[model samples]
Target chain A: MSTPIFANFHPDFYVERLWDKCIKCKRCIRECTYGVHIWDEKKKTLKEDHTKCVGCHRCSAMCPTNALIIRRHPSDFREHALWTPWFIKNIYKQADQGGVLLTSTGCALPYKNYFDHLVIDACQVTNPPIDPLREPMELRTFIGPKPEAVEVEEVNGRFRLKKKLPPVIRIEVPIMFAGMSYGAISLHVHQGLARAARDLGTLYNTGEGGLHASLYEYGANTIVQCASGRFGLHIDYLNAGVAIEIKIGQGAKPGIGGHLPGEKVTEEISKTRMIPVGSDALSPAPHHDIYSIEDLRGLIFALKEATEYKKLVFVKIAAVHNVAAIASGIVRAGADAVVIDGLKGGTGASPTMFRDNIGIPIELAISAVDKRLREEGIRHRTSIIASGGIRCSADVVKAIALGADAVYIGTAALIACGCTMCQRCHTGKCPWGIATNNPELMKRLPPEVAYEKIYNLVKGWAHEIKEMLGAMGINSIESLKGNRDKLRAVGLTREEMEILEVKHAGE
Target chain B: MPLELEVTPFHYSQVNKIIREHISKGEREFVLRGVNGHRYLFAGVSAEVSAVIYGTPGLDLGAFMRGPVIRVFGSVQDGAGNTMDHGKIIVHGMAGDVIGYAMRGGKIHIFGDVGYRVGIHMKAYMDKVPVIIIGGKAGDFLGEYMAGGIIILLGMNTIYPERPIAGLFLGTGMHGGAIYIRGKVRENQLGLGLKPYALDSDDEKLLESYLKEYCDDFGLDISEILKEDFIKIIPYTHRPYGKLYAY
Candidate 1:
């Protein structure tokens, strides 16, 4: 017999079946999309193959009785500090297949998560904290370019604005749905996101994939993206949303591109992307026409002109080194908003190497960009949206205090929609149905059911944001913007604090 | 009747504002003279309007415009027909880079040579098949990453005879589209796994129809332009990167 791979022989997860509690119902067999469970016909019982388990826990959750426990395999190779098990296993897999390692979602490496090391400040004796229930707090945020100065004129014994400003988008909450492409995820999830955004008075992004014809009614709450591929880009799609975003780079895989495989291009996806059925949809590493900052301005104006200057235009870039300079350039290029996605962003599919090791954290990026733009006196020209790795409402408050105008939450939204982050989304076998396009899996997540869940999550977060604001003795969210005095680093180094533009605790 | 103007004194933005204001006022015809380096002219004008421009126009001449016909007598800068939905832009002189980038529905007929990266990622939907017929040579990366639409490169009647009919990386990463070269292309000039083939009847019909329009616009003989043996290039497989990943 051929030698089995070590990872398969000693799997990452071990499924323990409590034979004492099992009733021979074989529910696990029906729920296992990875085909890990089976019915032993001779024994008339249920069995499992540990090697096939991705640790999604769908069967365990749906099991009638508490009969299963999925745990990490307590096995290890010879200990080596530098050469870890993951590197060894990945090298073995690459040697066997001789192809690029593909992965789903964000970086799983144990890099420093700055959000965990920072703390928010609260009111003390000098200022009393207000009660959120008894008092009204303003969480209303506007996203667009602000003029250099406000000018007023007297008309009919009434003072009115002298000049008209550009279009602005108002959101009741400071949180938004990150750009999730339609082909990478199911349509039900998109419908849920769109409806929830409408319900919450916020916006949801349509990532590069063209908007579906049925979702035209929700254009007022949508921000359609123009990716490098220019997929489904027409005059109608350009004007189909409240604003337009030009996707320059994604955080999970910076400097790389995106490709939706031909096999996954169903008829519906083909029509939305405006490509032929079964054709590979490729977004190259760069827009061939965009080679400089001026070129970036060209495309921004193209979308603005395409939409007849009625909608705000945003530019999304990965948070890499010198991000502050890049943000300033984008602001000067006529961008109304700059979305900086950090390295911890999620994706449906990306090369493993790029996903794990590219771009800086969003915290440092927000501080750097905000400081640079303010120094350049162009901070009012654009709004800064910090994305990637934002977890709870606390993270949103901290991000705003660190200098972001708002935050985009992707994984948090997915978790609310029943995603367990199995890390197997690219395999097209997502049991919870959040990432797959297969009809059988797609039916598992109904849009009507998922929209309510998303709505609850955002509404709950908005309330929590108000509470946090009240604790800080501030009743409005705008007061929290760039107010680093409310934040103090707990365990970060001096250099790190300097980069984040925050003071150390007990200083 | 055309609303005539001398657009030399105003900036490109001001000229565009004037054009937009006129377009919204039901003025469907315009004749602008001395339009030196004026960019974004007639942009996003979806009306069935027409413009006759004299002197050189800057970048993105008719970008995102629909239902408007523009005739330019001088050479244009970069990004002439950028993402244009529906219109006709007839350039009587040479053009710059990225002329037909992402154009969905329109006909761009350039009477002279074009710069690099022309027709990149130009796609089509239903009856909105975009067509670009180049009367002279093309620079590098022509038709690179094209998903759909038709590009015809006629490398003749140009000042740069030393240049190749089309440059390197022609149709690189192309899928779901056809590129027709007037004569022939070496195997090295083609994208990976893409091959040139003899024209079928349907291809000949497409060429005849599109070339007649080109010939009529330039006042050239259709027979002379079609005298050479043309070749068509289409990808061998729509899924070029299917086997590139392990999972």
Candidate 2:
């Protein structure tokens, strides 16, 4: 018999026997959102590339065989007396000092530069741009119920009240707070958000964490969330809101439960959640009551009945592979608005793997959802809110141009309110106490300062947005959304170019 | 006013939803009949409101009830009287699983068998302690992680069958509550995550009032039901598992 043509067809990187606790159950392979783990049948073992692991730990939870454990990869380098290990040590010091672990995109490690590689052009000649300082800048936008049709009539003795049938209301700016539950962040953070929203003429979200009795007075400016756990949910919570948000999934940790470990369920937290003290709060990934689009409609109507149809309903979903299809489904599900979070979103404490590798980019996801809704002739039926990695004013402008009626800010809001993103939120050891439930740590987030910072951030962004709009010769934000004809894709693949539907520059 | 109504499959009646929302604050007396397979009946109603279910009800019947009285004429679906504050829910027929989940105040009376998680996470406020009286056998996790209040399981069936009275994980994380399971509970079948003990005279007396209420609601002989033995379960402390990390 002829020898095998290629005997050394083995994977280059393989798990050593030391980590043999792994029973080759393929649980890791199945649960990994990053597509990192592979099965080597010949060796009857699992092959994992350290480079591919994002450290989400979703695999650890599903390992029924109790064979797999999750941990950070150990790195070994040649012992050098020079400035070696300085970079790594400095990174550690930054974390220890409660400083920002500044990162780009979803993952921290350098991959491919996409956003920075592209540039936006400004018109100097031909287009007579209005100066932001001396011209009328428009940021006014509406989000809720709009009339199906309009009718105008004149009366003999008095003018008619031209019944504008639209149920949708308008917002002065295209900005709002995203979902960040009470258990995920601190009460002070929520208070800060509430105050900032009221001050900035915007809306703040309660996330699925359930409303604390303390924050009930901010009802008009607040948006209560109904999530899987149904934590702290009651009649008062339902009625105390301007809008109700049904969270299907999060951009950072989609298709997974938001686990509030038992360690953080303090007395106050337990009271707020209505669960007994010292028990873990588990927010299921899916709403057990809702199974399909039609079921979602039932819930929407149920909320309407409970709240007497006084509040609008918004559906928040993660940006996933078929987000366009999902968005279309949500529109048909009878939601007044849809909020999509890109994979690059932030979470108080998500498995590192899911946070870094799962889901699609916000720009692509927003553009696709928008195009699908428009193509289906339902674009005007529901408002779209895009989130995830919206860092600066320019990104917000880009998101709006891509087709989002508004944007929800999460990580950026925390940053404005003294969050350094030390990545220790899971430990609840936040030095700034912005994400901790500990009484002492929580006290660090005073409502006064946090509110001021958020107000300043929103004001600065609002100003910049107007400047960008005026420079682009756009009169209003409504005129900018989904107007991709004014945008161009730079260095994108053919498929991406088609998906974004933006032409090549100068094409 | 005592109202008599009948519900068929096509009747499409949601008495629980309508009466609960429309009932003005402080209004009490109510009698409802003909409630067959209706879901979310009397959900989210506050205390002081009293109603009676004449027939079998759908899922989540009388959930989040406070300061009210709800008597089920027939077997109740899953999650009966969940998250109630204060009131009494008497089940003439068997009750579905997860009965009285997260109940704070008031009492529950079940003449027939009950499913799992009975009185789970039950608590008590100042001057208000919740109570649950089960007539037949109970499923697992009876009073699991109970924070406060009292639970009385009166196995009124005399002919002492071989089947276990309560299931596993009884009072698993019980902190500051009392659970009473009466009659003969086999030693080997006591199961894990619980500490069982005999009921005291004080405990029996505490259950006596709830037993009388149960008998009155279903028109059963209170003396016969009280003749049997009773076991009481009390959660160890208020913070059973200590402070959790997640708020």
Candidate 3:
């Protein structure tokens, strides 16, 4: 085989073998698909090729004696905080390939997690905490435009409610699966998410890859996306979902379009995406017809017309600097809801520079949008869904308190299904089979197994959210939404606290 | 054929309700008059019905419609026949932008001009063909990102014969589908990934059949329209950005 013009710059992981414990079992050699471990026939011992290791830890987990250890390669650069080892290595990578370096998953840079700094208030005096075990804590959330006021009438000595409201989707929990296409992940993963969404009474997004025929049975729990590519978009696809989301942008790569390489467009993917086999699926940066807010309104109404106004329509945008203004325009454009994808959002593949350096974090975006809509007296016009890096139930609670109706979890969902976050999803060779399309690798993940794990993960988070709400002296999740008085920010500037509409700690 | 509904004061929802109620009662043929800009008329109605609309219909007139024939006597608004699987929409007057947006299977015959991005992202599946025939000129970005289906532009009354029939960047990012223009097209007006070709016998046959229906709908002479020389624009390669990546 011919060598590449550019060599592998440096080892990303170090494989440490316990010499006394290894029994030459060769399990690591068999488990690693990247060829990181090889059995040396001449010496009758295992050898490590550290250069190929993606730090997925597949071999280490498979080792019977726990003889294999994987660690991040030690920083070898001179101690300079500004020009760190990661910075220098990325420079080398760009210099070698002269191409945009692609990475997967969320941002790995050290940014403050606002959720950790914000503390939820618990009742001590004046009010008492309700035990969730014995009390009924309503976690059900209705996502759509709420009515402005209730209208009642008395007809023939009988009082009746007479308010017509927009269509709303009710979910048992306020947590939902974010948009991730089938070609980006495996069919089994999509099935797992679909099953989990059905069991949890939530919705899972199809993420612009068109709905598969087999998954049509879960239409009540599906949110089909109509992206710029218009892939696999037909009348049936539009009518097969509970809601339709117009994907304007994603947080990881805000201003650019998505390029699914022709190589990844296998036969099944081609059918799902409605493109020719081996043809690249290029979603343009902007919808060709939607140039202004009026254009967006036209498309929104068009979709509503297509589905006969039976399904809620959502407009999803990245959390950019002007997210508040953009969100307001989306509401005015007749969307039933708006989703803001923050900078820490995960992706199947994105340029490393764009993923790490584009868009604002979800915390600030949600707060600003919420404040803007409230100031305009249009907060009840539509629902807001905050998505990015919501790690735990606390993050979801914090988001709701900051004015979000719900939260979408992408990377966390993948991690629940055995993903190690190796950030090699773009390679199409994921070892755990969650992000790859290779038939052999995809076979490793069974839909039933993934379904159970994800179901338990969301179920646990829902219980925790209920516990937090009960401790706050709130019986329903709605009472906690937009109730910023229940939260206090620590280590945040006065301006930051003002923007978040929360008080500083000990105020 | 005896049912008649006046949609003047009723909201779009009420209009649709009345139409659906009539449809559910096995009334396939109806006359809808006094339609004053009501949107979503006959949307997602998958029945073999014929609706004759008199006044101007609003946006998305026959969206997601299947197996129905909607004949509008007046003009229509934007997004007409949006994402329709199988249907026939005949518009007598001018239509707005994004006409036939992402329509997979059906036929749309427009008698007058249309706005920008007409037939954007239209595609076809196995044995399902979608066709759009425009009698007059079209705006910019015509057939943009067109994956499959066929679009024909017949410049019957050319305001400027010196200029090209369609606007700039025609067929931008078009991978599949064929565009037939019945006038002169300059090389500079064409977008990337496209190459102009002469009409083959099969192309002539397809154009003849579709134009025969179009002529029948609009009361035009098919022989006079076919007398003009036509040029066919198709994508040079199915994969436009196949070599844009390193790996």
Model 3, which residues run further than 4 Å from truth? Answer: A1-4, A14-52, A63-68, A74-98, A154-158, A164-166, B159-162, B199-209, B219-229
TM-scores, one per candidate: 0.94, 0.72, 0.91
Q: Which residue pairs clash within candidate 1?
A: none
Range of the 10 consecutive residues with the lowest summed lDDT in candidate 2 chain A: A5-14
lDDT per residue for candidate 2 within A77-150, as digits (tens), equals 47786645535444444544433232212344343333443345456889977677887778888896465555
Q: Indicate whether candidate 1 or candidate 3 has the larger TM-score.
A: 1
Query: Model 2, range B89-165, lDDT digits (tens) per residue?
Result: 88888887778876767788888788877776666544667788788778887876565678877666322355578
Model 3, B97-192: lDDT tens per residue? 888887878899988788888998788666677899988888888988787899999977544455557898899888778899997788878888
Model 3's alpha-carbon lDDT is 0.86
| lDDT tens readout by residue for model 1, A57-172 | 98888789989998887787899998888888787777666778888888888889998888999999999997789999989999998889999999999999999977799999
Query: Quick one: ranking by TM-score, best first?
Result: 1, 3, 2
The order of the candidates by lDDT, greatest first, is 1, 3, 2
Candidate models: Cα lDDT each: 0.87, 0.71, 0.86
What tens digits encode model 3's per-residue C-alpha lDDT throughout A1-507?
964533364777889999899998898887888999988999888898887899998888879999999998773657897997777767766666666777888877768778888999999988999889999999999999988887999999999888666679999999999999888888889999999999999999999888788899999999999888777777788888899999999988898777666656788887777667777777878886588998899789778866778889999999999999999999999999999999999998787878899999899999999999999988898999999999999999999999999999999999999889898887777788888677888888988988998999999999999999999999999999999999999999888888889999999
| Residue B41 accuracy (lDDT) in model 1 | 82
Best by lDDT: 1
| Cα lDDT, model 1, residue B5 | 85
Model 1 lDDT per residue over B209-237, tens place: 99999998889999999899899988777
- The top-ranked prediction according to DockQ is 1
